[model samples]
Target: MAAPHDVPSAAQLVAAVRDFLADDVLPAVEGRVRFHTRVAINVLGMVEREIELGPAQAAEHERRLAGLGVADDAELAAAVREGRFDDSALVEALRDAVGAKLEVANPGYLGDG
Candidate 1:
């Protein structure tokens, strides 16, 4: 059977390929081949997560930047340097942003999880 018309999206495709490598390829290989296959699987996993989480993360990031009165990271940094925003607010915003990134990059490192 094929994927439904709306099924197997970009994230799904990446996840399917990642699963293929992990389940079918990883165990079938050894040594350097195994190592590289593992890396490919890890990278594909990250890609899948990014596909699923990137849009929401981006929107949240943009909102954070807007709240800080900046267009982008560079502007945010400039604002920080100029002390244009509340220090506590800026720190909270940055920490929240980092946590959101860790959510996609690796939730385990986010501490609160």
Candidate 2:
């Protein structure tokens, strides 16, 4: 379904551009231009996924941070820098942050975690 605005919501717009680059532009280009077009398409694909997943990921991130008793990443990092986190908390925080990033940057890179 279209958004309440009636047409081409942000994710839809991103997908349209990504499809255009991959389907139309990729087939017609060659060498360096093709490589760059492929990169652009991948970037747009990431944008579309981010549009869809970023909100939920952000909420989860905040929740995880709260569980660690911090407000945001800076606090968590500062604690880590000061050797505040125990081994388990340090590992968990790092894993959650990296996992959230992979969910946007490259889900394929993630393991069963």
Ten consecutive residues with minimal summed lDDT in candidate 1? 1-10
Q: What C-alpha lDDT do the candidate models reach, one value each?
A: 0.87, 0.86
lDDT of 2 by residue, 31-104 (tens): 99999998998898888888898988889888889988889988988987898777897798778888878888
Off by over 4 Å in 1: 1-5
Worst ten-residue run, lDDT, model 2?
1-10
Best-matching candidate per lDDT: 1
Residue 97 Cα positional deviation in candidate 1, in Å, after optimal superposition: 1.2
Compose the digit string of candidate 1's lDDT tens values, residues 1-113: 13665766888989999999999999999999999999898788788888888888999999989888889999988888888988799998999898887877777786754
Error of 1 at 24 (Å): 0.9
lDDT (C-alpha) at residue 35 in model 2: 96
Whole-model alpha-carbon lDDT for candidate 2: 0.86
RMSD of each: 3.3, 1.9
